[model samples]
Target: MAGSSLMKSRFESFICDANESVAIQLVCSDNELDNEPHNHAIKEFNPEFSHQLFGDNESIFGYSDLRVKLYYSSAKLNCFLSIGFTDKVTKDETNGIEADDVVDTIRQKLSLKLCSSMDEFRSLLSKESQFIPYGKLMDSFSIDWKTDEKQTKRHFEIYSADILVPGFDAYHQRMQTFLWWLIDAASYIDADDERWQYFVVYEKRSPNGLSNGHLHSDAHNTYCFVGYATVYRYYAYPQRIRPRISQFLVLPPFQKCGLGTRLLHTIYDFYVTDTAVFDITVEDPSDNFTRVRDFVDSKNCQKLNAFSVDKLKLGWNEDMATEAQTRLKINKRQARRVYEILRFRCTDRSNADEYKAFRLGVKQRLNAPNQKQILDYQKLEKLKKFPEQELAFIRQTTIPALEVRLDLLDKQYKELEEEYQHIVERLAES
Candidate 1:
């Protein structure tokens, strides 16, 4: 027992949280690449996940004060990975287990070319100006974050292009590596597939006239890659396509400035006019992305005649779905969701009758799967003795589970309301 305890204690000493140990930075530079006159790293953050490279435990067993510096040039997205540590637990002392080969693991997982020397990295950084954003500029906007010296309302531009764009596959490789660190369950896309499209966000150094959704050549302007999204064009039956957002990510330093919302709006603008597109959809969105999506969808739905105050009061109508589909290119499922969001936006919680009606309507949608389960059971009975059998089934089975589902339903409703309230708050600010 004493040996076992001592071994465990030694093992604990080596275990380092991979997420915390890894440091990522966006290195920004102007004409002076030889010497960054100031701190060259404009933005620095750690990974949201590391288990894919560091094993399921997300720990690296044998490093102290580990600093995995993975820096990328802001303009070109060129990568440089450097792993450093104050101490390493060698296998000789540990009695058997070897320390993880950090660089080897990251090289395998990220599939990025690592810089062998600082000179090589700076060589790539020197040529950063030659790197231009791929594809056509689709939209542009500015965000204002205050600094001690000035209001840093930086200019940003979003571009949409096919994966086939010359040199884009290479660019995508470096950009998609960010997904491994930030997006959960993230994986790379096959750029060779013609159906995949990319929309990228970049921060342009220029100050004004960004609202035009177009950028003219300004030698003075240096474009820095910010965030990006990937979309897949799935074939809808009988000649239409459904464009689903496969992945969306805004780098940590750039988030919470409405860049994501603007990015989504640009994506919508790209497809809404295309007759070939059936509807827009998202695949396995995380909670944060879902809220952003809901906000965009509800706001778009609000512009339609079907989602007017009176129409919304009427609640989830056929016209709402039709208008949302043909005009906005939103699918039925998302349209229904937008309807509920807009409905909840205008619902008067203070009035008992109005509130009860809204609650019951939402509950009906929430209970649909449970209702289907009951029907499924009924169907198994050969559809015989419908009224009596259903009553008996409800009494025997549902009566016990009803209390549980009711409690869940209330909880769900509360969550939904809170989410809607947040959307409404954003909407108001916009």
Candidate 2:
């Protein structure tokens, strides 16, 4: 039967019929039902659970009982739960398992755990297939970046310098949303001035067009660069700098293909060789950045400091700094190391230390008579260098009045203390 032409033809016909019928049913059912209900059910199955179980081949189906059967009838495959026990099963209706049968079994098993609509089931199956072996698929579909570098430049212009171009606002906004989805979190990508300055690589369509669909889109086409160093500058000097990058986004359909790597390499190459950007810094560790980090490392790009702007910003607050100092032991040596890594110069280390000590001392002396003197001295020193107009304004302000009252109170208390000291001395003499 396996070798017979008639049997082979019949089997082929059955497969074609089953595929067409099932495809039609799935499409029709998908349109009728909403996927949201099943999404919540699937969420119960931890998003990472599939990754753990399947290890890339996440598309799985299972059944509760082995009695469930799948059959291809009238060119369409259908699943049914066994109704009753039978003494003997007929040869024509033999209980056999196929690949599809296994899938059906897994689906049934999943359905028992969650209330999933037909649409949701279909959607899940489709998505499951997409992510399964995505890395392998990407590797298989890899494109040579060098082969396309010149072609890409000739066919599609690659910009090494930061150009002032229009219509980037829309692209940047779109890319922000796309990157957020890819990274699995909402992150702002600012294109402010300071950040824009460091963005070296950019791409736009030439008068002709790109050979690859990944390079240029018919609707919206722009490319931008993003690195850790660029982000750090923005965070550090938010008031002084604006962020900038190419607006080109790697769409969902285009991802997992080597296009992402190619684009990134193209940009990197442009920076290193074409643009002469010697020092390139990426925020994420090589392992975490995945392909981008790998490409950079392959290119012999050096890894700089592992600086986190959020940590530096946290160090700005006194309480937070104290807490961090206590928890992390951010002493003078650590502070100096951080400053050296960040390239910040401390001109007056002793003065800064003294100021810190003075502040702490003032806090300790809050109830003392000299508290007024300490406060007045600090305030007067701060105001002494002010311009004439500012000094006059300060004199007119309530600050001056408060200072005068505090000074008078301090002098009167001092006079009383002196008199008391004289009386003590006279008593001692007697």
Which candidate has the highest TM-score of all? 1
Query: Residue 275 of candidate 1: its Cα lDDT?
Result: 97
Cα lDDT of model 1 by residue, 160-235, tens digit = 8887789888888889999988987988888889999899999876322222333446664667788999999999
Off by over 4 Å in 1: 1-7, 30-40, 147-150, 206-217, 382-400
lDDT of 2 by residue, 263-363 (tens): 55554443433222223344433322433333333222111222233433223334433432333323332232232222111122367764354333323
Top-lDDT structure, candidate number: 1
Using all chains and alpha carbons, the TM-scores for the candidates as numbered come to 0.91, 0.26
Each prediction's whole-model lDDT (CA):
0.83, 0.31
> What TM-score would you give candidate 2 relative to the actual structure?
0.26
Number of clashes in every candidate structure? 0, 18
As for model 1, its CA RMSD to the true structure in angstroms is 3.8
